[model samples]
Target: DPVVVLDFQSLYPSMMIAYNYCYSTCLGRVDQLIEQTEFSEFGCIGLEVRKQLLYKYRNDIHISPNGVVFLKDYVRKGILPKMLDEILETRIMVKNAMKMNNKKQNPSKGLNRKLDARQLGLKMIANFTYGYTSANFSGRMPCVDVADSIVAK
Candidate 1:
């Protein structure tokens, strides 16, 4: 049997933007909301959203496949999603520069290398966002729900 192999670049990161996944936007697991007392764990606006605004904006949120809820961009644009959009846009610009540099009659190899490195660095940032989000041991503010939702999508 010949199995088809396909890979989507930055799928998780793109999904995070499309689905609006972020610590500040996340509402925690649905079941946990019923079992836990502290809605404050999600942050100030998030806490208020979870406690009160949730009812008013019940139809305006996103519940991931893994049961993690996030506020939609219309309700409250996620910080991570905005950052990712900038990163991805800059990567595209860098890639275009690389192509234009390569097409030059006498392109500088050093400039090409620099542009390639810049694009690669940006891509790597998007590729390993899950690690960035779940890096508790590295002193990062761990966001399990957002990271898990990125993978689930």
Candidate 2:
């Protein structure tokens, strides 16, 4: 099978936007911003994580111009997709469990219940994947499929 070379064009940027409340910063109330954003309870956790990643991988190591690291050839070919799949699977499990628990806890809220962990996980994975696929190419890392193509050669 010809492996699909999925790319996250602006993963870092999108991550940054989400983490920083960029949309709200432009024009949104605090409540609206909090409600509309994901992972609000985590506060600056995402920002901190992004900073650490950039500092370690992008700045210190100087991997790319935009301060986003690309998966190495070996990692991309051998490990990345597996990691993504694992993430996806875990998300599904969490979401399902959460749904069940919520339903049992409040039967009245069943119809209006929000998604649990698994659903969040699935959304996270999907968003990450989509970001990668739709990222702009300018001043960003170029595509490299040597990893995905490893099995073909």
Candidate 3:
């Protein structure tokens, strides 16, 4: 099968904005307002609304450490929130595998169950490596060593 590589620009920054509640200054101010309240019935309602909005916004931009933004706003807001769950599950699985592998316990089960997650993580890393390689190798941001490392693994 032909590889259909899709590149997302500024994936990490977007993800951070979505996942980390780092979006609008207004939202931050609203959060502060909510926190300072002395808890009235109406104030509680407003706080709840703000909290929901903040949660929704964060879900919209779920960020990964390697800087890949899982761009699915519609899915994040509606449909299903499987993307974030999958990403989190993968992270946990990878961490477990790495830890167990270090202790030589044969992490095959964890690795196999979380292959897709592992691949996603690897893809993000590979993307970064490719960027660096291109710059270092071609006078842009090339770093063949990075590419070689990703490819070798």
| Ranking, TM-score, top scorer first | 1, 2, 3
- Comparing 2 with 3 on lDDT, the higher-scoring candidate is 3
Total colliding residue pairs, candidate 3: 12
**Two-way TM-score contest, 2 vs 3, winner:** 2
| TM-score of each model, in listed order | 0.86, 0.31, 0.24
What is residue 17's positional error in candidate 1, in angstroms? 0.6
Q: Of the candidates shown, which would achieve the greatest lDDT relative to the real structure?
A: 1
Q: Which parts of model 3 have CA positions greater than 4 angstroms off?
A: 1-81, 105-153
lDDT of each: 0.80, 0.36, 0.39
| Model 1 TM-score relative to the real fold | 0.86
Give a tens-digit lDDT track for model 1, residues 2-96.
Answer: 99998976887889889989887887878776566664454222453345666777899889999988889998998888988899999999999
Writing each residue's lDDT as its tens digit, candidate 3 over 1-153 gives 899998964353233223431111112233343564443222113222345654666655433333222334444331112333444455656766666665765556555656656756754653343344335434453333222322332
Clashing pairs in 1: none
**lDDT of model 1 at position 63:** 93
lDDT (tens digit, per residue) of candidate 2 on 1-153:
889887853343233322221211111222333344333222112211233433443322212222222333332222334445555566667666666666685553544245453466465664554344333464132222211122112
Which candidate, 1 or 3, would have the higher TM-score against the true structure? 1
Flag regions of model 2 displaced more than 4 Å: 1-77, 102-118, 130-140, 144-153
lDDT of 3: 0.39
Worst 10 residues of 3 by lDDT: 20-29
Evaluated at residue 148, the lDDT of candidate 3 is 34
